[model samples]
Target: MRIASLRQGAAVISEAGAHLLPMPVGDLVTLGLDRALEVGATALASEPVPYAEEDLLLPYRPASVRDFVTFESHVEGVRRSVDNASGVPAAWYDAPTFYFTNPHALYGPGAPIPRPASSRALDFELEVGVVLGAGGTSLTEREAGAAIFGYTIVNDWSARDLQSREMQVGLGPAKGKDFATSLGPWIVTADELPSLDLDCRVSVNGSLVGQDRLSHMNWTFAQMIAYASRDSVVVAGDLLASGTTGGGGCLAELWGRSGQQTPPPLEPGDVVTMEVEGIGSLTASVAVG
Candidate 1:
């Protein structure tokens, strides 16, 4: 089932279209979305509300956010673009590697991402976000798979200049990435989206820029979740993101290799639209600080 958190209330999008549940938006968050779904199932559904009429919010307020780089093509593209000596590290193939991001910085669909005052090289990452249901430490891949609640589109906004400088110190992307991370349209339950193979695409200001298939991922979401849950709890509402897909998924990868100058980095008033086949599309406007 498709679930959306709106400014008005929690809703379920069915073949009949968007039907509001009686539950208040904040109460749905406090009750846990999974449980809210259960309650909404049997309750008298209200009249279908046109989706565009209501203001949407982030489907889940994540307990924590973890993003992983599982696309080998992205890694190779980065190395080639930056002229780095080392390719993807040998240890990367053995285990999935990830970094924690600022959970408080997440934005919903239609939100504006302000270009950090310190950054000029602004970029967007097109990805899929997996939201966990409940799981404990050291989960097996199967266990982790069962713990998944749903999926959503993620646009991990990046400040390439700040990111590159900070990585040189081997510590953080703290200021580089903490500015914004966008998710939504709505969350599609795992049962509704059983396959991971989906077409992912990105466009800026009406022109297509990046496109790739999720089937090409070198590491699966199950593995990423299992690795993340190792010796740590992955509770309901925790978010894990599949990193950018291959091809020209981001400006850093595209311009970095081709030296193309026609399409420039994001500027204020630019609209970024990201779509992953099953989850849906998310669009955000850019604003410079």
Candidate 2:
């Protein structure tokens, strides 16, 4: 069963039909499959359901969100792009790593993305995100699949210069990224996007910026979850984005800003569209004052 957030509330989509449900994004997340069925039946209406698309929203409302950088090529490209001292540390290869962000970033599709007034070099990372189904610790790789609920498109908006300046301390982006990030029109269940292989792309306005397949992640979801569960707990509705892909990913990758001859900074009014093959596209229109 697939669940989606719409303007009216929440809705369940299945072979039988669609029904309006009143469950919050967190509840279905924590409750898992049982809750999904319960809410579906309980919220089923006696009348026929409508099938309009405008009212739909992304299926993310996690208690928290953590996006990881799982592509080695992305790391290498970014290093050269931003003039970093060297490649990612060897520890980064030992296991998966992640950074948290706001789960409230359920910006509706077509929502205009803000151009941070503090930034001159803004970029977007096109990624595939996984939604955890329940709380778990020391989760095994085999068991990790059961903990998944679905997948969605994630755009990790970035301010390149700010990210570079802060990383030397070994922390990160802070205000460099506190601006805005975006996710989803719907969360396609694990069963829905069964195959991990899918084509992904990042386009600026009508021009292509980055395009790659989802198969390139240095660390897979199962591995990340397993590694994460060893020390900390992953709960239902916790989202993990699989980071950016190869070339055409972020501006930091495409144009080596501080290292090579710099390209003209991205002007305000630029629109970025990122899409995954099975899921959907996330479109952001950038603007600055």
Candidate 3:
């Protein structure tokens, strides 16, 4: 069943729509989405309330957010664009690489994303995100796969110029990315979304600018999760992103090929929509702060 965090409490989404329920006593921060999903129908204390996608918030705040770069094509393209001699390194193939992102700053569907005042190069990274169900440490691939509760679309909104500058210092994507990360529409329980062969696409203002398949990721979610859980606990509500797909996943990759002047970075008021088959779509407008 699809679970969503409602204004009043937690909700179980149906084919017809959302059925609101009060969260059991205790803060969701402590209880986590894993326990909520385990409670299942028992959490619904009332009849279904009036609900719409826009009225909902992020399915839940993640306990922690780890985004992985699992796509070789994306890495190759990015490396080739900047330093042609360097390709996907041997270390990258040895293990999946990832970075921790700000979990405090998040947005749900339809939320207006404020343009970072420091960025002239704004872009979007289309990705699939996994939300863990149960808590575990040093989990094997099988154990990690079982811990998964659901999946959602992740719009890892990026400030390209800021990211490039910060990486040069070898310490961060910190302020460059801390502003916002958009999630939701809703979570699709893992059982329901068994296939990884989904089509991924992104459109800006009415044009299809980025399109690819989720199957392009060289490292599977299982490997990424296992690596993340090594000697460390990954509790319920922890988020793990599958990183960007190749074939024009973001403006940095696109602009690198087409030139910054041709397609231009995202401007205020531009509407960006990203979709992954089966999970649903997330759309937001760019607004200047």
Candidate 4:
């Protein structure tokens, strides 16, 4: 079933139609988790309020967006273009590493992703991930799998100049990547997907920019969750971002020539759409002053 969190409020899709959920998406995911688990049923159904998709806010407000460097294509793309290197360092394969982002940074699809005047470079990072369900630490992979509710997309908007400046201090990305991140239309249960081999892509102003398969990820979701939960709890509404994929994901990589240059940078009129094969598409337009 497809579940959406919007300004009008939480909702889920059923045979009847789009139904309003009893509570907020985060609250529903974090709150009633134990109740749903206790029942041991396929899903929790509810009556939903009518809200226009465009007018609706969105399901973000994640407890946190724990980002991990797992997609190899993204890694390679960085190395070959942005990073002053050739490939991922030897230690990258040692284990999963992540950086946490505040939940308040959440934005919604169709909403304007601001391009700060403070810096001329602003960009998008196309990503997707598993939504962790209610649970505590020490849960085994089998248990983690059971706790998983579904998946959603993220546009990890970045301030390139700020990120580079902060990285110079060695603490890394601090307020740079914290400015904004968007997620929505909704979250779908894992049962809906035939396989995780979802084909995903990104387009700007209707022009294709990034396209690749999830099969290319250096690390899979199961491994990411297992490694992440080594000792900590993967809570009900906690989110994990599967980083970005390849080709033109961010301006940090597409700095020079290669026949790809976003001059005038990203103006207010620009529209970017991200598509994940199994899921659907999310489009966001750049807003100007």
Candidate that would win on lDDT: 1
Q: Give lDDT tens digits, candidate 1, residues 15-116.
A: 676678776533444455468668667442666766672388877688889988888878776555443433677877988788899998999999889999
Put the candidates in TM-score order, highest first: 1, 3, 2, 4
lDDT of 3: 0.78
Candidate 2, 114-216: lDDT as tens digits: 7777777777788888888876889998878778878878888888878878877777557667677687766776776778889988887778877888888
Q: Cα deviation of 31 in candidate 1 (Å)?
A: 7.1
Clashing pairs in 2: 210-248
Q: Write down the worst ten-residue block by lDDT for model 2.
A: 256-265
Badly placed stretches (over 4 Å) of model 4 are: 14-17, 31-51, 254-264
lDDT values of the candidates?
0.80, 0.74, 0.78, 0.70
Per-prediction backbone clash count: 0, 1, 0, 6
Task: Give the CA lDDT, 0 to 100, for residue 43 in model 4.
Answer: 32
Off by over 4 Å in 2: 13-19, 34-54, 86-88, 104-106, 257-265
Q: Which is superior by TM-score, 3 or 4?
A: 3
Report the C-alpha displacement of residue 187, candidate 2, in angstroms: 0.4
C-alpha lDDT of candidate 1 relative to the true structure:
0.80
Q: Which whole-number lDDT from 0 to 100 does residue 207 have in model 3? A: 93
Across residues 12-40, which tens digit of lDDT does each residue of candidate 3 receive?
Answer: 77765566655521233245445655655
Ranked candidates, highest lDDT first:
1, 3, 2, 4
Off by over 4 Å in 3: 24-38, 42-47, 80-86, 259-261
Residues 170-276 of candidate 4 have per-residue lDDT tens digits of: 66577668878888667776778758888888888998877877777787776777777787767777888788876656544555324244432566778889999
Of the two candidates 2 and 4, the one with more favorable TM-score, higher being better, is 2
Judged by lDDT against the true structure, how good is candidate 2? 0.74
Query: Estimated TM-score per prediction?
Result: 0.91, 0.87, 0.89, 0.86
